[model samples]
Target chain A: MVKFFHHALKFRKDVCIGCSHCMNECPTQAIRIHGGKAELTDNRCIDCGKCYMVCPVGAIIVEADDLSRIFDYTHRVALIPNILLGQFPEGVSISQICSVLMEAGFTHIFEVEHGTRVLEDAMTKMMEEKELPRPLISTFCPAIVRLIQVRFPMFTDNLMLLKAPLDIAAMYYRRKLEEEGISPEDTGVFYITPCAAKIAAIKSPVGEESSPITGVINMDFIYNKIYTKVKQGLSGKGSCCLPAMQPLQPEEMVWSLTEGEAARMPGRTLAIDEVSNVIEFLEKMENEEISDIDFLELRACDQSCAGGILTSGNRFFTVERLRKRAEEAARGNDSMIYDTAGDSIRDHFDYLNEHLKVTQIKPRAMDKLDEDMEQAMLKMRKVQEIMKDLPYVDCGICGSPTCNSLAEDIVQGKAHVNQCIYVQKRWEQEGKLQPKESMEILKEIWGEDKF
Target chain B: MAERMQFEYNVDGGNFTRAGFASSEIKKILKKLNVDIGIVKRTVVATYEGEVNIVAHAYSGTIYVDIDTERIRINLKDEGPGIPDIDQAMEEGYSTASSQVREMGFGAGMGLPNMKKNADEMHITSEVDKGTEVEIVMFLNNKE
Candidate 1:
């Protein structure tokens, strides 16, 4: 199988229970059952990590960056997700979390929400200038970017030129270090991500520009370590402070929640969460029905990034916690970190002055069944003809993802119609299959073994 | 094996949720057949607009799909009050959709124009208080 996207996810075939959960849940229908085991067809995979989320037996795993590599860089900057602030207990301050992370061996801490604020400012500028395409699509979620690249290639123009917030944070941190006499090769920017798709993005960014991230750290992997470190009083003995940049606003912190972006953009906007829902919306968007809208945010996770596969807490609980925290922060209950009264916070843009992203990206289509348009049309007509005869139940008993998949597999000579249980039963009732034919099927499935 | 395939679907009117079902099915079939994605996308746009037109305007309708090696022709016929002025209805922003259908994002008067834009050939004939029939033909071999 061809290597799809970045190999951000690893598979352990030893623990696979052959439940087919991952196969059925895949949005791209990339997984198929072969010889009672699940196999991924890398050509169609967008590396969305739904298979990793759906695997019940712990067979599918995301490849986590080795924490030991962080020591190799002279300056190691950790980028924290806003959702992580809500993952902690009710009383833990942002300073406390940063202190614990610093104690845990990080040289500098950069909040992902700061990157979000930067993007909001840039996007606001773009909106005011009308520089971007209408109905601007967000690149916050890497899975959504890959989805658009693979499935909705025609909507590539609608995608906003801005990269993910982590990318922005990494760029900011690296530039600041580079100006301070630190080389790019000597400085590391680590993103504590909540999903495999972000890891994929860190490995291979959407545009032609190089990825800014040096290492991809899984959130849930270090959740308990940070919790224990904070509980044991390893750091934050008193009120702590940060002199780097400003803290995230209430509206900015909730960007991980569903419709969080739309809540800020007051217009005919649309927000869709969940992979299937986003796919449907993208299909509709591809038809150009959403031109009346200004912004469209499509998230692949259940409750946006808060409900990611690597998150330790439930999505609803995290959102509720964030809501309460945002309320308290609004009332000035939380301790202040960054020096908001001085001009130092305003100098944050100085970091991006020389490192602003300037690149172009074109559509990278997944695959074409046939190269010739006329031959492709003939193939489609043939699929329509084949589909009329098969059962329309979409039963995955044939080892394909859907009945349409089975039809394609048959046409591609990868599968036979007899693999369908319904076909087998009908054949048996009609005396179409002899004892010899049944043995042939057994040999095909289990290999030349006498039973 | 059927060298030439034709699919017929009866589109029930007033079922907004199910309006795109036939078109979605057609998309899946076209995708499975390995059709050019651009052509598949155009066919889906035209076919879906036609299907939605039936669900939003007509009481009941029948859609016939004729596919060969060269083209996929979709003809939609409905049994309901038809457009009185076909030219006026063809114009952009000219809609007779009720507030209920418009609120559901079904009718923006972009259906016929979009169908015409996507399909290589389009023909619409209607009679007042009778019914309307729409035919869209998309060439499979065209680059545009």
Candidate 2:
């Protein structure tokens, strides 16, 4: 079965230092090093971009758009995320930075604030209805969605079916441009993104929309260009000169932070971050231990998307900036802002279908014992028995990540007992290395090193 | 009823934080077997709920899991205060958990219902003051 979904992140082997940093640090344990090179298991990788952050030599990269297509669109909408608002230097608003984009050739800038308000209103109604299962897991994070697919498919029903705010923003404009007599194909929406997962989301969205976004431009990929423009006196706009640009309210801006959506949920809720901690909580939820939880907002980054690997600023610094700006914007009159007026913002999301559902996917099976259950039991016993004969220390010297893994690999027919250096040296010292099985092991173990 | 292999776990009821460890381990084993995803999901959900009940409501328990060619069966037996009314226990939102447990966001009386909904076959037997035993079975090859 085709296991892993499409992932945009790439691992460049030539640049990899193979320090085992990505291998040991992977939350899902998707990466392993063999022959001094790193390999990512598609089945185990959730595309959370964890390895990208941990790679010291910058071997991991998400394919980036050069922004060369911006001029191709007759009407361009630069969809600046709220996270980007936190990236600029102090005293410079995002509109000022966006003005730099306009100077770079963007026709217009549409802040993704309207979609945030629509999500708030729609989710509030869903919360009030209380129709779905308790603890509705937020579907906003693409990495979290993939996490469920590959690790916790049982909770598939719990994922909120609403399209992500990015999709909503893209669809919202594609139609608005069409309504204004501009061809839908003529209007291009480019997302200045925070992570590679978002870029993957644009290419293969969970919802049914085929290519909701026209293109995606990575945050750090264009940071220097925009920063240089700001340095070149293209910024410092006093008023909102960008067309269709709306000030983001505090509630909408908080969505970029961890637990931002769950805070709006008044009942028992949880907002979790960091891929490892997120897995811990998800295991409890899967066990039905935390049924009282009404909502869960989970992010793959340590502190939310501000902590994403694609961002320019440090997480703590940028989160502070984002929160401060959002607080100031919340005190204003942004269109479709969340307030006590209790009005429906469904009209804002009219470009999207009334009901959008994420395509259900399943996890890959990596450690199957055998095709036959009866044979599988026999294999299990053999593995356990072989484990006793080998050293217990979990050293990853034989290309396998651990001693236990090497034993399993032996049983899986991927490796042999002699691949272990300790086993080979012990046999050689004891003068028992003449056995045919031990000789075969001797050839492969040292084939790359000594043989 | 003969099984190819049976696994056992001793659940420590004292630590509510470590309640899902056994269930997580079981899910890994099942995944390694290349079991059907639907069956694996149900098995994880149902038995996980069973495992948590031992931690939350009972004193201590032992979970016995038997993996067969066509099915997976788990029986969780606890040695603590048992339910006086099994039917009422199955109802949603009827929990006898202490306020402390409730404060931690558990004990909404949804655990048993979640177990029943996920398992292909579920059987619960309880004796007042003796203990409660939950048996959940999920078929691996049942296409329907």
lDDT of 1: 0.76
Please give the range of 10 consecutive residues that has the lowest summed lDDT in model 1 chain B: B28-37
Angstrom error at residue A290, model 2: 1.6
TM-score of chain B of each: 0.95, 0.95
Which candidate number has the best DockQ?
2
Whose TM-score is greatest here? 1
lDDT of 2 by residue, A28-145 (tens): 7667665566788776777788888888999988986769887788998888887777787686656667667776777866666557777776777777775687778888888898
- What TM-score goes with each of the models? 0.88, 0.83
Model-by-model DockQ, in order:
0.34, 0.42
Give me the displacement of residue A4 in model 2, in angstroms. Answer: 4.0
- Residues A1-451 of candidate 1 have per-residue lDDT tens digits of 4454775777676777666888899998888876556788765677678898878888988887877778998788888888887787767767788777776678877777766766776666656656666787777787887787777766677777776677777777777777788888989888898898888877877674688888988898767777887788776774443545655677767877888777766457888999999998876665554458888888999988888888988788888988886777777764547665633323676565344453555655654555554565566666667787689888787778788888778876788888766777778878997656865764454334324
Clashing pairs in 2: A367-B32, A368-B32
Candidate 2's iRMSD: 2.9
